[model samples]
Target chain A: MKMLINVPESVVPDALRGMAAAHPELAVDPDSRLVVRGDAPVAGKVALVSGGGSGHEPLHGGFVGRGMLDAACPGEIFTSPVPDQMARAAAAVDSGEGVLFVVKNYTGDVLNFDMAAELAEDEGLRVAKVLVQDDVAVTDSTFTAGRRGTGATLFVEKIAGALAEEGAPLERVEAVARQVSEASRSFGAALSPCTTPAKGSPTFDLPAGELELGIGIHGEPGRERRPMMTSGEIADFAVDAVLEDLRPDAPVLALVNGMGATPLIELYGFCAEVHRVLAERRVPVARTLVGNYVTSLDMAGASVTLCQADEELLRLWDAPVATPGLRWGL
Target chain B: MKMLINVPESVVPDALRGMAAAHPELAVDPDSRLVVRGDAPVAGKVALVSGGGSGHEPLHGGFVGRGMLDAACPGEIFTSPVPDQMARAAAAVDSGEGVLFVVKNYTGDVLNFDMAAELAEDEGLRVAKVLVQDDVAVTDSTFTAGRRGTGATLFVEKIAGALAEEGAPLERVEAVARQVSEASRSFGAALSPCTTPAKGSPTFDLPAGELELGIGIHGEPGRERRPMMTSGEIADFAVDAVLEDLRPDAPVLALVNGMGATPLIELYGFCAEVHRVLAERRVPVARTLVGNYVTSLDMAGASVTLCQADEELLRLWDAPVATPGLRWGL
Candidate 1:
């Protein structure tokens, strides 16, 4: 692997140490693999906690800060965190209000977060759970039992975190989180496969002139593999798949996300094509984000996600958010 | 070349269109290839203008917003913009306080910006220039007559832009820009070559299991090529090179920047090693940034930049700035 890591086993801990050092506002516990806001568990506010694997960074850990996730429990690369980590994080971030678990739709993540929630309840902590299954890529990929949660995890965290920052009750926050997840859909394409450090080789082989459509973030088999196509054609395919599962009447917030190794310029190009396709269908875009918000290790690809947005959700998304990965309106 | 672009020729304009659409706060002029603050020409503040090739997204264009460059003129990918674009940008953004040009050290860039400054002077606009030559990679590269400006261009624009935002005179702003350039040094590595869109192939050849150290941002040959080394050894080499040119007595602002295709997880791992080496040397880190701020398109590698920071520079760095690429303290 050409990755810049000390050792495959130590990548997560070392990265966490660096993250903690970079952002003083974050309190990172390497022992437990939990990242939380230094001033978390704010009184009378619902706390948001989310996590998955380590490879898709800036997702759960980088989103832990003011007006976003209150805490995150990161696992090893492409592996779900254990229940102990989640339970500890919940206990740490749960104020009198409650704690909301933003679990992605992978089997391991769902099981672990469920166990953690039960443990937290046993400890007299109010816990609510929202499962995000926004990916339209496949239903039951390698590590997932249902449609895999992808970019909408970020949307749910930002919107629900905004509602929580308003001192909303736990049920209200959970409802908003569910609403965001239900309103969203994502589809990804990969021109190249990413190598997992431990694996020491690419998870899959992508010949130089071929591409995979609807690939999962963990290098799971996609809907189809075809000879490489132009970016415009690929954008059309991804956007069409996402739009198929989306409601056309409501204006949407679009996220053109890079799956790791794609450059920003390419993302911008893909985003422009996405907007063009949406415009042709007369879909009003409420907001648009283009970057590597969610990613597979170093896969060269992009994903298109569309979330039907209402004024409330838009307000929540536009609300001040200060995190290491996504920061705006502070 | 595997890239997500529409047409090679239209990449610059198409990317700019997407940028303007994504960020309504910035004014984008496709006709002149300029990105400026939506509400520019602030009555009394010095206007900051910087630009170069278009491939470096968020460097010049994405940095055009509050507390950064008032205007950016992007040319074709990895090609210096013509004088007309810069002249028009300067005239558009210049307020009564005058304008300052932040030019990177490349023959084409310096010559074009100099011509543009002369043209602006003919129009009765006060202007000053600061040339950045902070890349410790090589004293001269293929496209540059001296040490090529790389990551430090961002530092110069940010710190100098902060001074200009505070209504500093043009000469003072230029002085600070030069100071930042002088105090900073950068070195990069590339595991693979970047293909220019027009070229339709990799800029250079690199055999598998090898890496280029001290590479220029534009795919220029580095100081040496060697077998691929572990991330720790690479970090040591890059940090040592940067520190050789950087004074250890002062607290330094460190930037571990990815060259487009490097993943955030790997960047964090590399950053951790950088901090470890700096700590061993007892070099205090005043501030640190880890991300793809400056990039070579789709190149899978990273660069390390260190700027010796004084109180003024730190204050400017800490000041609130809201641009699409870098946003914090706002």
Candidate 2:
């Protein structure tokens, strides 16, 4: 598979070990498949936990720190973590205030987090779950029932985590997470397919001169394939798809995210077009983050996520955050 | 080219435009092709300026901010910025203390920055130049004389910029820059070749299951190509290449950088092996950064840089940095 891994079997644990080595501030438990804030379980503070697959790096795991996710349970690549992992993460991070699980709206993530929430509740910990279904690409997909959560997961985690860091109640944190989720939409376009370590081949067939629109992070069947388009054209289509679904009345915090292998130079070029399209539609951008935050492993593509932001959400977003995936204003 | 760019001709300017839009904190001059700190000409602070080809992103431009670079001049892809751009950037950021030109050791960059220094001197500005040539991959490469500059540009900019931020004179900044450069060594290995937009094809043919070692950032001929190796095996070779030259006794600040297209998951896995190798060799790491900081556009590979860190260098490295590419303690 031409990947820089020892083997397909140990990819997840090896990466977790790497994460542990790089960021000693985080308590990385390779055995539990958990990444938790070093000083998690802050007394009486709401704890935020999220996870899904391993490939979308810096998403759930990279977001764990001072003002983002309290803990993350990463699964094997493109697979969901079991309920045991999530339950253990909840137990590790939950304080008297309770735990808020930020579940992406994939079927496996939803089901597993739901079971974990019950497990946490059974253990006498207050648990609340918020599902992020911001991907407007599909209502049902290869591994999802409703909309597949994508970029807005970042928005939800950052804003909600900000509130939680302020010692907000678990219910408030969950509500804020839901608010951000409902207020955001994402669309992705892939120029190449991602090849998982286990699979060792591209999950899908995307010819060199063609591209897929509305593609899922895991290379799931997208809206359609077409001849490759220019950056501006891709921006036009992706932003239109998001804007049509978002129809925002307020300004947005724009995320022009790279899907794994897309370079920053290209991300910047694509982000300029995204800004141009948003400007043409008279949508005010409250803030913008451009990088590989939510990514598919080594997929050459980009995704645009827009979250309608109010003053409170903007304040929450601008709040200090220190995490491997996203960090700012700290 | 199946790139997220409008056209090869406009890629640099468009990406600059994107940089401006995304980071309002930086004064990005698209026409002049300069990215300067938003608050440039900071009284008597030594102005740090660096730039080279546009492909290695977040290198010079993305490092412009409060604690790193004062200005950067991005050239066309894999091409050095003209003397005029560097001269103008010096004019924009110099506040009488002096200007320090941070030049990579590529032939074009060294020549252009040398000319730029002369121009700045003629404009009644004192300018000192520091050339980074810390790559141990080859004594000389296709575009370089002596050692090729690679990951240590980041170290030179950062440690030197931290000193510059404290209003150090040009000479001291230049001295520290040279120190960091001399103390650091880097080695890169590539799984796949990078394709420039203008080329629209892989720069070189790297057959499947084969990889190139000691590759220049522009896919210049490396030491050799061999059958693919595991991340640990690659780390063993790359770290040996670096440590053989550096032989650091003090704790080192390690930068495990991705060559554009390598995913974070792999980078982390690779990082774990880097730490293991360093530990085995009894080399202590003062700090570590893992990501695509200095990149060759969309190359599926990575580079390892180790800078022998003394107290002063570690303090400077720990100093606040708020650039787009690297940020902490701000």
Candidate 3:
């Protein structure tokens, strides 16, 4: 559980300073703990904002940029950002065209962002929300509220950001974001448990030669724990679950994302296996991506996401997207 | 070093099968260890091919698609794919126009890819090469042969792939690829070493509370090892080095790439820091990206790359790209 830092309390503040220092285009509000692009109100464009816990690097924060989110509020490590921070971000990026909040389907994230949206509304701003619930790992909603948003969050950010950049109305952007969430499904398997910074211990007991399949992004236990299997077998289990949830004979965007510690080689192997599995089923893959898009903190595992895409969805997917987390087309 | 696998030797083969299955549109030649899109060798278009060791996922392999490379050869984990594999890939995707090889500046990668190019030429195929030596971490040619290509490879892949996809002449594509490689630069910092599957142990020792700055992609020792610093400092070191090398005043593309184990939250913070740093220098950053693009096994570290983009480069970056690793535009 060793980490590199002068003090645990300064991790967030010091990190923000450095972030602002490195990305001049991004404006960092130390007091509010928000990072935003220098041009607060993007002129006549609709603004997109997203934020969540801090453990998942590049998720809500890295996605703040042109063709994506206008700002991001990063909470302390593994903790949700307060409503005030989100409020500040909303105020900073809101344009007359309105603002969209891209929230992950987490209790803390949803509640906090909801409160912030209300606060912004009180301040005479228009805000809409798109909740991302793409993770198919958990079926029990009683304890967790809903399925966790994992790799599919990226699809929402990329597409919604693109839509917003193209000056789509808030309603259209929110609808498209929701569509991405619906069309996309994700599942993860972790080989090792992550040790939270505050807890300073393993989140759960995963024996030396075992894996937890269908795990949550927050390091929670999964649907099953079995003897470690081959990458091919793991791919079969993960991909089949996602494909089963999504209908057959549809074009889909595939993502083989690393949980955290898995090597690119391992992830590539996983993607390779996923490709083979889909080919056998005669699935039409419209697009494919393999990388660490959404990640756990040094957790040795990976996730697979399949987003069904039609011509319009594909066009939106291909549209220019510029974010700190996902950037393309310059 | 506890990996989830039925057998170490079967990792690559099983992964390949899964990839071919999942991305049926992307063709995989098991015999040659080559992966190409189903619609490769487009009529009257020059073919672009690239590859190297397997650890840096999505580099030469994940980039094979419509707007990027036509084919990719996956070598053994962290080892350059042999010349025969490269030859096979060249043959599979080469049209009557010609082929361009985008090679990272690793000695093994350069040697292997160069040999493959010679073999392809001997087979009566016109071939050109663009060697990437953008990493500024190592003294250009002091400790090693030259700076190791790390994150900048992505820019080369995207821009070069775009040119090839647009049916640009082989000479034009080769020139564009070379321009990208020269204009881009990268540097990395690591908290821990990545373990090679064959080795079964970390390649280097990173003391519990220390970090290695300016490390190469192959787990090579970095320029400096200091007590672990905050994420901001890490970002500063990497961003400062890249900006110093590029001195870009016009809009540029910024990439904050995780080596492997670092999470997205940290990368996001790092991106924010990078944005701040560039702004201070009055550099106009056109776009930003934060993720795990070029990685080193499961190393806990990150690298940053900066690419100067002009109109032509931007067009290529925006063009449709489809591959198992990166897919965009229809």
Candidate 4:
């Protein structure tokens, strides 16, 4: 595969080293695979720590900074980080207030974060946990025993991180995180499968002229595969899947996220169709974000995440955030 | 052509419409194909107007907002925007203070921007132009009579726009734009070719297991295609090409930009290799940005742009600017 990497084994550590160089503001620990805010352990502030496998970049690690996660623990490509990494990050970033672990719904992630929470608690640190299972596409998937978390990981980090940054109590921060998680849902469709550095080939066979609807971020089998569809059709299906699962009465925060390799031009074009679909469905969108925020490695597709936002959630989302992936109002 | 688009003909307008919908802070005019700052025509401040072909998203259009371009004009995919679009954007954003046009070095862009300057001048608006010819790949290639302007367009717009935002005169803004262009040099490599919406096929053939070095952004022939090299080798080659001519006397601002379809993980790993090369060459980097900033549709590769920065350029780069693509500091 013609991918940009020295060797498959060195991908995560090399990238962490690069991240440290590019963003000196983050305290990157390549050995422990932890990326912590430069000024971590902010006095009395609830520290947010979230992470998952590598490959889906700018998700957990790229979201660590002033108004987001206090630390992140990235695992190998498409593999869960062990409990030791998470426990080390929690210890590094936790202030007197407490630590909150934002774990996605994959079985590996949930289990590891669970063990990490216990490990931190055993050390006299108060740790709260919230699992993000916002993907409406599947009830169970290849790596997940429940609905896999997708785009709402961003929503959870931003909204809840805002509360945490405000020096909210750990329980309150945990509540807000769970609240955002319950209010969000995501669906993804893939135009192409991605290749892992280790595998050096596409994860699966997705022949030309066909698209996978409801595909998981890890290229897990989706609801179905059909002949290639236009952007409008895909948006309609993805949005429909999300809205059907979450018949929201409140206005929504929309995320039209690129699955790694989709260009911005197409994302914007697809976003317009999403807006059209939402308008027809009478859902007022409070805020919209479009980009490769949470991504699979080089997969050419997009995921739609919608959070039914209350005034409080909107205010939280609008707060200043200074992460490498999502920066605004700072 | 498994791409995310409606009808190929609707790509530009659709994306523009989506841009408007997504960024309410920017006034996007679909009819005129312009993205203007929501608060335009700021009196007594020089304005920056930039535009080019449509496929490169977040370039000219995404750069339109506070502390950046006052407006951007987007043309059809892989095609130059006409004089009318640029002239209209110039007129729409120009206050009595005047407007500066930032044009890339492609022949159509330079020629049409020249015509647009005359049109705007005839309309009683002071117009100045700066052509970015930063690519060291070739002296002249498929779409240009000089080195193809690739990544340095971002540096010019950002540095010069910061100066303009500080109420600098049009001539001064124009001068620094030229200064930035002169100080900057870029080199690119491609693993695969991109497919345009209208063409519905790969722009050019790039056989598997090979790569083209010193590639122009539009899939133009580079120096040569060789069997694929590792990321370290590519970084060595790309940085060598840039620093060979730059030979910086001051610390440099480095932009390790992905040519669409390369993931952030790989970009960061590639960035580490880039840093290693620069460190060994003893070229100090003042700042580094890693992402898909300037892109070639969905081509898989990257470009390295290095600008030797003095204190003034570094200050301008650090200033607060809010835009869809690049947002930070206030």
Candidate 5:
């Protein structure tokens, strides 16, 4: 598989230990695989929690810090975290304000977070759920029961986390999370399939000279496989898919994210084309992020995410955030 | 080759445009291929200038901003920048105090930067050079005449930039840069070869089950090709190579850097093993960074860099610096 790992089954635990060693500000629970801020459960503030599979790194775990997720529950690669982990994280991080569960809309994730929320409520803790399903790639594929959540999960976490930090009520934070999800749209293209550690082979076969348009995070079947296209063409495909889902005449926050194994140089070129296309369509852009944020193990691809940003969302995004994966203004 | 690029020749320029678009705080000169802080050439402070091939994202370009390099001259992919570009950057960033050139010890880079420094001197600009050759992988490899410079370039730029920001003289900054370069050492391994854009093929070939120990950043031959080893064994190989060169009894700064294609999850696990080995050796670690800081384009491997950190270097590292790729304490 050409992967740098120990035993396949121990990847998650070993990485968690490494993460704890790297970032002293984060407190990792080896028992539950939950990563929370050292000073978590801020008094009188809403606690934001999110989680998903482990392969898409820096997603839920690396985002746990100031002005972002308060706690994150991580599952095995491409598998949903169990309810016990989420329940424990929720119970640990819930101050008086309450806790909000920001979940991506995949069948396993939704069901697991639901179960955890119920478990937390049974413990007399206030809880709310915000589902992110912004991928325009497909409605049902692989593990997804509906449109799978992709890059917009970052937007929901950042914007909603900012509101939570400001001591916003649980209901208000959930509303903003939903707003970000609705306003954002994402589309991805894969140049190569990723090999999971246990499998030791590619999840799917993609012959050379062909590209998968609108591919899902887990190598799910996309819109179609076509001859390799130019960077401009690929950027147009992703931006057009997003624009079709939601035409943004107002200023938007755009993220040109890499699907693991893609270099930053290519991501920058793709991002330039995306902005050019958006400008040609007369869509204003308030902020832009170009790098690998959400990834699928070592897949070689890129995803474009656009979220229609209002004043409040922009302000929240501009607020100070200090995390291992995403840090700025702090 | 599966890369997201338009034309092979346009990769550098297109990516520069994208970087300029993504980061408005830095000014990118399309003609000279220079990325510098928007408000550069601060009066009374020594200016820092560094550059190299383009594929190593966030190394030279992304490190340009507050408390780092004043300007970075980017060359073509895996090709050194011309003397003209370096000369232009040196002239532009000289704030009358002086400009210090931080050159990685590749033959092409050293020759080109030397010519540029002479040109800058003819223009009556005070300049000093600090060459980084901290890689213990090979004394002479493809494109390099001596020890190939790798991760320590980051430490030199960061620590020296911090000193310059404090209004230190040119000689003092140069001395500190040399100290950092001398104190740091690195070793690398690659699971797969990187395919250059122009070549449109892998730089080298390795069977699926084998690995290259101490591979160069540009796919140069390393110590040997051997059977794939476990992560713990690989970590030991790297740490042992570095420790052989310099044994540190004091607190040291450690960096576990991924070479483009490696996933962060693996990096964390690998980083954990590196720290464990260091702890076993009774090395006190004051700081650690784990990510793709210096990379070969989409190469699946990693490198370990350790620098003996004194109080001055630690203080400088902890100072607030804001840049596109590396940002903290802002």
Candidate 6:
């Protein structure tokens, strides 16, 4: 419950100013609330755009740059970005080709991004969107919406952005992005609840010595709760579920993501267990990444994402990408 | 302090397995404790390598991919990786084009990596290194070893990796990486100490209302301890110090990195204040990135990194690079 801040309201804006001062390659459109790469309208390439709640830093906005997203809209802490922000982001990053929107499977995000896309389309801009529903913890389609997109969204942006930079058309980019979504699967578990800056206390109650499996990124309840297990056991259940859902025969890409609050040491512990489980199952892991790629707001949990990699996927994966959040090969 | 684990000793190995399962593009040589890109020995490009304590996930290890580092050596949690691991990483990724070792300014990391480079040289391998010393908060390099490189190391790896991927010789990569190290500056503030899984307690003491500024990534005490301030005021002080150190007139690349446990909302708040301060100084804010790039265990802190960039640095920033931790335009 300890924090260093002047006031709760100033957290977001203060961070934005710090970012603008620190990174010169990215421009902050204060009025629009968008963080964009300087030369965003990159000629003929299809621009990729995404945004959501603000508590998860670098998820959407930080990934805006050369090889990845052209622009990202940061919403209020844990709240979806309004349609105006998304609409402007889509428009600013749009080049001659078109723009692609990568949306997580959350009601607020879906509704808002969908509205923004419609507005962009009305503006004579071509915008296509691929909804990411990679989370496997939820299964009720009648009462609630579909599974919430968790970790796989990172892979979607990564591959889709690479293809966009390669001058792939919007349709092709959307198709591959969707394929990644279809092939990817993710599940998460939480050990503690996180407090929203505005709220100042935890959103939920998670007693010590317990873990919530199948949790959502928003601090929502998971499918089950049990006594806390070692990182090895947690990795077993999470990676097993993802592997079962992905069912990959060839080598696969692994995205072991921390859902905020989990230490890097523990994440490595999770990764170690996952590798052992996969090895035991004879699953060929083509590559591996362990970090807080997609995170919640200090929600002491982690998620696992498995993407079945093909030659095309690997090529796209290897393609050059530059964004405020991720930059390499220039 | 609360944590979930089985045996503390197995944390790092378990995490590595999980990372391998989650990211298939990275291949883990468990025996050697080296994580290399699946396509390592990248045919004809100089290999780039980095590493340090295990707590900073996605740093030295997570950044192994196409456009970034060719290999990353992960040490035990908060402990530097041994020399053999770095030697193995250098050997596995070197394509006869030499290797550039990018090490942060930590005594353990520098020592182990230096020893490893010597070992590689003893075996007739071409190797060069750049020690990152960007943190301006910890003064008094005259008495102790210089400032501890915390967040700015990412900028060094990223830009230098781009050059190496573009066929820059080992010397050039090392030189440019050093230039980034010298030009960049970073400082951090921690609200709470991180609990090591093994220790099951915090690495340091922090009161409920105060913060430690200029802390290292591995729980090292900062230069000052002060009552917490608004995100804006904190951002101002941090920015002013960095501006004094960097004194950049051109556009800069900004990295507002969360140590861990700090939400994106908090980061944005920091960013907003930073932007305001830079505007006041008439510093043309060029590129801005806000996120949790490098992190401590589960400490609630954030670091600001500024890198002066010109046309060439910007071009290199845009170049295609692939690695597990950072994947972009390929």
Candidate 6 per-residue C-alpha lDDT over B21-118 given as tens digits, one digit per residue, 9 for 90 to 100? 56666797655677888988987899999888787876877778766788888887878889988898899989999999988877788888889999
TM-score of predicted structure 1: 0.98
Ten-residue segment with the worst summed lDDT in candidate 5 chain B? B321-330
DockQ of each: 0.67, 0.80, 0.31, 0.82, 0.77, 0.44
Question: What DockQ would candidate 5 receive versus the native complex?
Answer: 0.77
Deviation from native of the Cα of residue B320 in model 1, angstroms:
1.3
> Which residue pairs collide, candidate 2?
none
Chain A TM-score for each of the predictions? 0.99, 0.99, 0.95, 0.99, 0.99, 0.96
Which lDDT value does model 5 have at B117? 91
Residue B217, model 2, lDDT = 93
Candidate 6: Cα lDDT at B126: 96
Candidate 1's residue-wise lDDT over A127-184, tens digit each? 9999999999788889888899999999999999999999999999999999999999
lDDT of 5 by residue, B1-330 (tens): 878989999999999989888888889976669998888778898999999998998788989998989999999999999988998998888889999999999999999999999999999999899999988988899889989999999999999999999999999999999999999999999999998999999999999899999999999999999999988999999999999998986799998999999999999999889989999999988988989989999999999999999999999987777777887874
Residue runs of model 5 more than 4 Å from their true location after superposition = none
- State the lDDT of candidate 3 residue by residue for A226-276, as single tens digits: 988877799889988887788745688888887777776677667777777
Candidate with the larger DockQ of 4 and 6: 4
- TM per prediction: 0.98, 0.99, 0.80, 0.99, 0.99, 0.80
Clash-forming residue pairs, model 5: none
Q: Tell me how far the alpha carbon of residue B234 in candidate 5 is from the true structure, in angstroms, after superposition.
A: 0.5
Where's the lowest-lDDT run of ten residues in candidate 6 chain B? B139-148
Best DockQ among the predictions, by candidate number: 4
Cα shift from native, residue B40, model 5 (Å): 1.3
Give interface RMSD, per candidate.
Answer: 1.5, 1.1, 4.4, 1.0, 1.1, 3.5
Q: Retained native contacts per candidate, as fractions?
A: 0.56, 0.78, 0.45, 0.78, 0.70, 0.76
* Residue B246 lDDT, candidate 4, scale 0-100: 91
Docking class of 2: medium
